[model samples]
Target: MRGTGKADVFVMLAHPVGHAKSPGIFNEIFEQKGLDSLMVPLSCRPEDFDTFWAGITAAENIRGVIISVPYKVPVYHKCAAAHDRAARVQSANSVRRQADGTWYADNFDGVGFIDGLKAGGHRIAGRRILQVGAGGAGASLTYC
Candidate 1:
């Protein structure tokens, strides 16, 4: 289900998403900046995305959506065009369905991870990080 702009930002939280720290971080930023946006998590089951998005599309206040897990792969097919990397990887961690009914998908995990590592004071520019699995989640990192 989607919430209208009675609030500021709307975040779609997928299954097994209790581990997300975005709400805390974003909310804190919103509060600090005195912004009206409050990020609320949308608890959606895997099968309910299409049905949920139907109403979300009809709603007027949702700025965007943050996808996770199973939804990422599915959203790729649903979107009109995905970012180059997301197209190559066949997955997406974020999506935006525009007013003209065009969906754009992009993967931000790789950059986020690298940035986080660097911000944590780790030197990986000329280093190697071993990843045991080079499967779905490793698609973006394999080349990094």
Candidate 2:
């Protein structure tokens, strides 16, 4: 059974999440692993972020959140703690609830980028890499 009341919940949060892919990918992983979990995709306008975040933080059953786009930097600020990757970039691609119910942030954009390149048989060691954007995700790569 999927997404029972007792299931562990996760959220993918972005401002305009209609094109997001992580929720479907993660839900499929959970299904294949036979985990009682669900990943929900949610969106909120920038003006309503604080209210939306407060409610999300209060949902005790939500085990984690994968953040994207405009929310990454802001979500990093909301964390009680963070890994060096997130702290360095001041952006959070992912966050998990701590024992105290506070979020702990981690940004994997840089790591993921390099890993993806390596997986595709590309090397970054001797290349002049040019990242075009300067958004939250861009910060991670620039500082990674």
Candidate 3:
């Protein structure tokens, strides 16, 4: 809880968010960069999504959100704009608030996955990729 009244807030919105590690990772990055920002996890069930999104949107300090799982597609539809990749996959893993107070959605899971593999010395070119599951994450990876 490194947040202060003036800190820019970012949220990881997910159902069953107890397993999420984004807050720790983003918090460290913010601290290292000397940023007055905080990323927190918000447990939002599918049914409560609308209310949660509405509340967060009205909060001036909330600058962005990382959406996950059951809310990805729904959030994508609600966004004012979406990246091509997100539109193709029909899912969004992140959203940023625009100056006009609208949110823009984007999908980065696939890119992140590939980047991680490349960082580990794995090459994707000419390699057959086999992924299990056809959920939001899988759909994003497949689209990439």
Error of 3 at 117 (Å): 2.0
The residue-by-residue lDDT of candidate 2 on 1-144, one tens digit each, is: 889999999999997998899999999999999999999999999999999999999999999999987899999999999999999988999999999999999998988888898999997887897789977778888875
Superposed model 1: Cα runs more than 4 Å off: 1-6, 120-128, 134-136
Worst 10 residues of 1 by lDDT: 1-10
> Using Cα atoms with residue i matched to residue i, what is each candidate's TM-score against the true structure?
0.75, 0.96, 0.91
- Say which prediction, candidate 1 or candidate 2, comes out ahead on TM-score: 2
| Tens digit per residue, CA lDDT, model 1, 7-120 | 657575567778777777777887788777767667677778788767666765565677776677776777777877788887777777677856687877667777888899
lDDT for 122 in candidate 1 is: 92
Give the runs in model 2 whose Cα sits over 4 Å from its true position.
none
lDDT per residue as tens, model 3, 55-90? 988998899999877888898888999898888888
2 against 3, candidate with superior lDDT: 2
Task: Report backbone clashes per prediction.
Answer: 0, 0, 0
What's the C-alpha lDDT at position 26 in model 2? 99
Candidate 3 — which residues are off by over 4 angstroms? none
